[model samples]
Target: MPRTSEPWRKPPKAWKHEPGRPAPGRTHEQTDRRHPIGTRAHEGLRQASQGTRTLRTGPPHPMSTPFETLTALRDEWQALQPLSAENEARLWKKLRLWWNYHSNHIEGNTLTYGETELLLLHDRTTGNHSHREYLEMKAHDVGIEHARTLAADKSRLLTEGDIRDLNKIILKEPFWKAAETADGQPTRKEIIPGQYKTTPNNVRLPQGDIFFFASVEDTPPRMAELAAWMRRELDSPTLHPVAFAAKLHHDFVRIHPFDDGNGRVARLLVNYVLLRSGYLPLIVRTEDKANYLTALRLADAGEIGALVEYFQSLAAQSLEWGIKAARGESIEEPSDVEKEVQIFVRGQKSGDPGPPPRTPTQVRELILHGVEPFFRILDQKLATLSPLFAETGKPDIASVAQKIGLLLRSTAASPDYRWEKRFDFFGYTGKADAPFDFSTTIQVAFEPADYRICCDGNVLKSLRYDEMLTKEQSEHLAASILKAAFER
Candidate 1:
């Protein structure tokens, strides 16, 4: 090798600049692809790529377009496809059972989740209910299977045939059933499966007027048009799947195409659209029936924004539940402890006005006191399950677990923790630091204005203005959060 006298050229030092300056890399123009050039920008990019940023970006805000909001939810759900596949069969069975119970219950099927699960999973039924309810539950499962089978083939479109089939499955070869007429006379009505109404069916309005749907002759064509619209929207890249599903649901109900089973089939088709489009099926909780109907009525009157928003919100909830389940995290919905505590506190305040309203400071102190017992109880529970955390062999984790238990319990108990606010108090506010991760904060509060309970920065529940929380509600919410922490 000829020894050229050229000095050894060193690899240019990684152009390190002074602190707080941009790193030596691409030019500003090049880095402007998205974020600005700096440590902060890099940190954001890192968090975004790893999805940590999304932890705070929950269901799309109401101000955003429904399509956009639902698309974000769908993206999150689609991202979990890998984890969902791990135990797809088992997860799906659970989801299907839940969907059946809620959907049917919303339409007056009258079966509990536990009962539905028992029947579907073990072919056994429990509790005291009409045999008709049991039959309806079984029939709903059939409808679910029909929808899922149809959904598996993406090329298939929502059709009059599909809707009729779903309705047939729901009604299960219907026969005459006892019913009531608008005249307050009890009677028996012919029940037909897979057919449009031959007689007039109407809903009573708040002002004592009957609202009729598409007439018997109009039902078939209206249904055909609805199916056509769904197909067109399904092909639209700009149309979010949840919106597509919701519109299908709304329009179907307005048509009242079937003599009966309109609501059940409408719900089934909604799930069909969702499942076909690679999203998790959702349940409009029976607990939320009033709101659900109100949303539908609004949608029927050319005001679909609220209904669309509602469905998108449900999709987001479904995404969260699926992700948690897939990740082996707790997927339980927190109970409404805020209402329970509010009722008790309100009763106390009304009966005895001796103690003045609580200051924020006093409110905070009482919440701590209420949770102290919870922490002690949780500690004993965790002790029995020590191996779960002890296996990590991180004393810090065990300690953090205890701290998290307190935070979870405190936040849950906050609503019921003796309130002493200044105004004719509507609700309470709570805050706690997550164990080990002091940077991570947890907050919960009741927003009386919206009748919503927000926990850990997410809206966990929506209650009626006068709703009261119960012990079962408070304990259920506390247990879910505590189990997640202890397992974590």
Candidate 2:
């Protein structure tokens, strides 16, 4: 690593470090090594993590070095924080699209940036691609949301389990990919989501050298070490978060714990670190991949500065975008225009046939086919049981009068959208004789596009109605609800 990765100035008058004394906020109160965020690749550095270091707190000249530039932009953005509040909604939307595109793009997800944006921003899918591919993109978006949620929890520290959960979320479900054994015979590997690779996952270099990551057996401990180091480092203010995030990313890549999606997870972990540290989640554009990989290889050969600078540059790009957005400047780039043109041109070429604009009729059809049967089954069961309760069950199994209404929400050309209906069965059967002596409200409901069964105020079964919920599904759901009632 180059010295520039940790630029410092003389200690400021307002702060001082005593050799035997702990740094003001630095605690020796051992953070749970598994504090939910670490792998143990570098535990040796934990002791030295508390060493005294100076941070550059002064202003920087315009167009200076990466460190100075980052500091200056960070301060500038910080000052604009109040006014930038409005910009965040738009910026976050753009970022979610950007982060999803580049992260998956680097891993050969075939969705164009435009398709990704539409799929995410509009909940509409276009493009001629494999259903699995589209699902992967959506799943990746979900994985990002998961990471963001985890980062938002101030009580969370990184953990091996969290990282595994992230891998599971991004991959969603596992399938098989063709592979070869050491003997070079063709074979297939099953990728179980959330599980580490059972076999060695290595890559062949252009020059025929096999570049290997931590072995399958070595993965768990190393991941634990890395998580440990990350949580410990997070408490130290010495390393710029960009560098910390970059190093963590590199270490994760080296571990390559999972059977697949390691790169994507590493990128996500980078954002997790950044976001949790109050920094912007960056987009490592797919176009810069060659330079990015080279930086990683260079870091592998002991020149970590290249990697640090590379990530610093990316962090700078995100910061620059923020600074521009905060200043109310047009943050549009040529690529943004190109992406729009691409989507428009694609549609114009032969008319992009998207899913027929969602109709209320479709929503209604779901209710009729998917939801109505379940409600009917529940109602019939309640009526059947009414005689057992007799005088005790006061209401005697009255079903709600099937009130269907259009809610105040609309989307995708469906003005009379948002279909919802509820069927509730309420009764009081006391003295432990009728229906286990309980007063309860069980509702089979369809809110907007979701079909759910509720007991009291809790949802017992929920599903989104894109396709008709089959009779089998409805019957099974009703049976499950009745079975639960009998048990209680």
Candidate 3:
């Protein structure tokens, strides 16, 4: 019989080593199945693809709806951004491998945060993988590096060094090179040559370039002018820090100073500004790209309010997600809130009272008529629970309403209610409107129990009228309200 070597057989005692560490010359074999080099890049591409898919599809679900898949991937992306550099590197390695395995499959390739990060790191540094893998590895590396810096210090205070460090980390890798003409003017290449003579619209920079994007001669002068104006705007005491940062982000991107990577760099810069000014980082997921870009474009054309509103919404969404993730709650959505909102709004316009009003005034009326009695009951229950609001010397209605309004407004603006129109509606109208309508179809349109607070399409809080008011005092208040309404 021909001599046969068993490839599966271990090479005697010499090949084995300590159980924990890898063999001397060999790096640890990934139990996670990620490629060694293209890890981070793979994850970046996977996340980008997933985000695109989610926006195209609906929300997350068990059956792996495209939106669900994308949202899952995005959550992973957000989680990984704040890890230590070493941990991030390790995670990217595994993430890359995980991405590769799932690259061809729509159903089977799912990766958690840890797996995606490791794969991304492994695939990028090793360079042992295919070119496609290499590209993905590079992209993910850039993305994660940026994300890691964003998460470095959650207190939202950064020093000059921190800002410089961010700039270095984000701009260190060269993504693309500048093309110049005889007068030192930058040249834009047709990405598709004769078939497409126009500049690549959304091209990102490659690895290791002096600037994040290509800079034309005129671009610098224009940027200087814009920067000067921006400085003035930033110095204005009237501008809120959050609003300033959001506007700056839009203005910088509109300048498009670099040939590529303008959007990414501008966003990163915005995070730096926000963090330095005591605000959280904003991750504009690829799924939100359309709205994000549209808001920026609108601002570029002098629609500052729209952009500020968008940023405020984004900030609220991000914070709520951060809080939920911190609390270890599931961040995925089971229903398509965007679609639901659209449907609900359409119903209202079509004279359907099954859905609450869409406009702010209308929503206010609904809250006053349908939701305030419930809130009053809740207030009574809270007083009974803690003896705070029911204290004999408690302030009068104007004082109490003012106090309640202030408290609820602050909480309403938190991440929990920022993206949640329903909560916002209730919070704004419950205290502001007295003797609210409890009979109008629009007032009692949707059951309170049916509504939930969502952050980036994920539910963060849910409550029923009774759940918020469980005490005897609350029960009595509720009963009285109902009794009076019926009597009328």
Candidate 4:
């Protein structure tokens, strides 16, 4: 017996193309168009009912929901704070200097650990600098002093035990406020008898009834589990030091074992990992807090691809800034490549017909079709540059041509493949002078689901179709085609 196809399913609602842009239904034209579609369909029935009229209304805007409001608040907070290159360079220098100084002090060169801790604690507690700034100041103070007294002291390198001890010492300070239960109960806030002398003040969460002891939680067991996972994943002998450091930083922050000061400790851990692996310590500035948080949040949500892309971008920016600082170049606002990518994505689907479908193949195809024009143009430019391959030390023209052929063949072989034309010239240089510089976009979609495909600023196709393919099959085929087309 032939298998019957399931009823066509609608796509999951796509994110509004532009950040902060209201949904399309709120637009006057959209509402008007929707009314006419329903009204025209029931015109015969209305005539039979003696020209009766019925107005249609939708549910109130979901933006008023508490979760939506909180999400908006988070977005606003992220937008209000941006990290700039100049601040990042300054912070990096400070951290390096402080690390050197502290290493020397710990090695009994001149300053003692107690004195270093006092300086850091005072600076941090008094708000002499922002939390990130204070870290930079303390690290640099230590690094500079270490260089002056023991430039060749290889023995001063910090061990794992030293890191643990440092964390303990830092937590012992009264900088972090502890959390309290939200029962409105009044109790003595002083240190209890036989309790550790280094207890911190307690505070309550904004919305929860739970309490948190500053930097003191039952985290050892969790930390051990996470560390075991890390050791297993990162034990490769040939891993690039920078990549390893980035991964470690991401994993540590995700665990978030510390009740307070996790950010500070995570930054230090990244530096320690990098330094131990022969890379310079990096200073992620407070000014870059929005971008940092965005990356971390995305990672926490299991978007590993997006997080890796963010890290690659951040690493590149840090390196470029470091080079500029070394050459005495003015450190101004760095170009935000991540922002550019986001803007490009938002612009591509700003006026989508509606939400996308749920089937994996449909979703994959929607994204692929949306980005197809950009890839097509990019491929064309690469083809034009094929003649300079030998000079550029890249693959030969024949190999590139062969790869393109394979991509075209694979795309043509797919039953779900569809092609559409789109105009996209945001970053194009030569085409600026051309009158009709529209590009060709190929949209490949699966049946059995409804998908909305848009490119540049226009909607191409919006329809409900059968879902004829699985997600894994779609991804495997799509990846092969794209790899052949673009990687060549």
Candidate 5:
């Protein structure tokens, strides 16, 4: 066939950049027939496709937000600086357990704490959780790990893509879920992982009012706005991490960007803000579901402080535990102690032997791991009395593990295995008024079956191998020591 003159140089008829033209491949008739939208509507679609519109970003934080109180806790947690390797492992491990348990729990997950522990920690699964719920919990845990990794990378800036990716990660694969339509008809909605919603969604309030999130057409621009705001604020952080986290979570939730997993991704984003800023994640425990929802409801009604304060309390509590972990104290919540014990008992009954107990072979490793954190916890307790004294010193720790030669003792393992751990805090309290120097020592000696806890050559109590020194005991011990130091 004969080609047209300079055929390569001439653009296609469709590619002509003429005003009032149809799209590249479409004829005017076809374009007009397919897109009956008017000029204004077409422009709206174009803007929606671009999603470049920035939202009106709000203040970084509520004006009434208090900083001095939160910062003191934050600073102390930070000052601890580079926690011991063992404590760091323990702290993160415990946090991981709680984070997984509670995040799912507030969403009406039926898995008990023990069940969640086994699934996440031991590579085992139990309980009557539906296959979907089980998979979701696992996927959410993976999302948390991914978020931690992402937050640790100081170089990457926040982006809408990351949030969508998180929604995909936690939601795992796309599937249909039961949802109500805009007209309140029950139906299954197709969820495309990592994709924005194609339909509008809303909630029915307790008082029968219809509450709404961002419209389907508005999600993209609003999400883009949130991501942009996050990036800019990270560069110049004016708000406290807690406040920032609250805002990030609330904003993401308001947009409801993804069809499914928006709530999970929102919480993930909150922790992302916290982790990047050297703070612990604020866990909304299952028990606090009512309060959490109430706070968010109030926030939706223009009372931002309610949500901010709710988060501030959680952040403050989180900081206290972080400091505790940094100082070698147990970060286990009160419920954690009971949960740990119950799980242990369940394991024993089932002969599973959960989380390897201190064995004879691993005695040194156990002692090294156990004593350092114990000393750190005890040191903080003693450190408080320093202001009343003239000078103070860092606590000293020592441990020796060997069978003690007892004159009369009978046991199945013939004295089995034993270890001694000691912590010493020494200082002078009275420079002129008292002019006295004192050394206070606490020791825990572990045998095969039980452990003896002592202070200054006196046995305080002997607890079974499973028991931990409770906070009550520690507080009483501190008070008694302070009293004796002054009286003596």
Candidate 6:
């Protein structure tokens, strides 16, 4: 077992170290028995992580590091100190669920955010999801739970054992799975929980190239070096927490230590770093995966600024959410959380070809009865607009009105849309259809004076304009509103 010969530098000025007098500096060769020589198997990592410069001392000062900019963010999170334990617990739970969902989803875990929560919180399962997905979700929850435990215990420093334990949690009981070879041959690979890679692995590049990891033979020593680097950085106190986490993630992926679950373990450890520093965990949304990968690629090229900045931004955002939750404010749940909750509770399948179940019969009846007369009147008035709609081939405004009216009628009657109880005023109910989410809401609200046509409750137009629309104009307006709402 070789050890790192690199000398330890002075701790960062901002961070506190032991109060005793400085000990005599010793050569790394004296410590080589404990720390081993970490071989750089991936040529790119040697260039990217270790610059070409030959240094007489340790790496550059914390001030010169790319993570220095994260100081303000870290300070902001700390200044909101003394948060109630209840608040911390609530925020932590919310973040854990979110982080678990996104991280697992990125790795192709089939459980939706809702299903993940249902399994974790309610001990319930909703869909006919695969057994592997359920186990994956369960394993992630265990890993996060362990991270939280470690984060709360200030005395526990991160160790190689901890890293392996996280990997073990992620892999759980391993089984045979399909894997690709260096040249892209499909093969069955056996995974050993908590163990390093037994075979070579390569990542597929967007441009049809392969990015190979450190050789399997080098994984053990590289992991030793990583543990040493982590301890050194954590003790230094100058490296911004986010940057430290980012660096750790980058180096771990560069090593690609395990045959599987390396990415998942890397991300979990990133949050582990943040949590240990008294900061909230960042949930890297699956939607930002492309940008996230871009940041990593940039870091792999020896340009770490992008990855650091990305981590800082995500950390700041997560801290804001934590603070809000701690203060008893209603933090917005992830869009997936609400959507998934609805799916399980309401039994509405995702991507269902059929319309969602209809709203209550009373609500449907109200919409149908109230919309019928106006539609009839509009149908009669559309005769004057024949010339304007000639190209439509429907011939006249009545035909256009009829077609559009039918859709609106059907949409309002569907169970998939919801009725805003607040807008119900005897005749019309404010109804909405959030196809996937609140990003796009097709709405119909009954106003005091006239009906409002809207998307997500933002009124686009009023059905009654000056109370004097020409017959043809009325027909066109009605048809246009219906088209916009249904098209969305």
Q: Give one clash count per candidate, in the order shown.
A: 5, 17, 52, 32, 1, 7
State which candidate, 4 or 5, has the greater TM-score. 5
* Candidate RMSDs in order: 20.7, 25.5, 24.2, 29.2, 19.6, 16.4
Error of 2 at 326 (Å): 1.7
Worst 10 residues of 1 by lDDT: 419-428
Which digits, one per residue and each the tens of the lDDT, describe model 1 over residues 159-226?
77877888888888778866767685777888888877786677677567778887888777666666
Candidate 3 at residue 314, lDDT?
A: 57
List, residue by residue over 1-488, the lDDT tens digit for candidate 3.
22212111112122234433544576543311121112222222233233431211112222122323323434454554564555444333333333232221111222322223334533312112344344433453464455446546544433333333433443344344455543446764422101111232333323433322224444454455545544443332224444456656665554455443444545656655555443445555432333555565455455454555565555555445444544445443322232234333433444323323133333343344334544555335334322211122211222323343444445543322221112111111323345232221111222222333222343322322212212332243344333322333
Worst 10 residues of 4 by lDDT: 3-12
Q: 1-488, model 4: which lDDT tens digit per residue?
A: 22211101111123334322334765421332221112222232122122132111122221121222322333343343344666545646444444543333222223222223334543312212245334534544543333323323434543334434444434443343334433565543332211222333344443554334323343444354445533432332222333344445665555445444445555565555444432345545322333455555554444333333444444444445544554456543322232234334433654533223344443444344433333444345434533422222222222322343345456644434433433232223332353322233444333333443433332333333221222332333333333333322
- The regions of model 2 sitting more than 4 angstroms off are 1-65, 83-86, 344-488
After superposition, candidate 5 runs with Cα above 4 Å error: 1-65, 351-488
**What shift in Å separates residue 397 of candidate 1 from its native position after superposition?**
41
* Candidate 6 clashes between residue pairs 3 or more apart in a chain or in different chains: 2-36, 3-35, 3-36, 4-35, 357-415, 358-415, 441-456
1-488: candidate 2 lDDT, tens digit per residue? 24332332212122134322344675422232332122221221122222332121223322123555776777777777865566876677778888998888778776667678778876767755787788889999999999899888877687889999999998889888888787667899999989999999888775688889889888887787777767766543345666667678887888899998999999989988778766678887765555577678766764455666677677778878887888888676655765666566545645556423334565556555656665677666655545544333322222222333243223444333322233333453545544434445665554443455666565545444333455554554555555445544
Residues 1-488, model 6: lDDT tens digits: 23232211222233122222122573332233222221221211222233332211223422233222344555566777777888777777678788888898777775655567778887767555678788878898899889878777877688999999998997889888889876677889999889888888777774688888899888888788889878866654434466568778888899999878888999888988888876778777654664577678767766555666677778877877866865678666444344545545444545432212223343334344433333444344333333322122122223433444455466764333322211111211224342121123335554323344453464433332112222333344445434333333
TM-score each candidate: 0.56, 0.59, 0.34, 0.34, 0.59, 0.59
Residue 22 in candidate 3, Cα distance off native in Å: 69
Candidate 2 accuracy as TM-score: 0.59
Q: Is 1 or 6 the stronger prediction by lDDT?
A: 6
lDDT of 6 at 415: 31
Best by lDDT: 5
Error of 1 at 231 (Å): 2.4
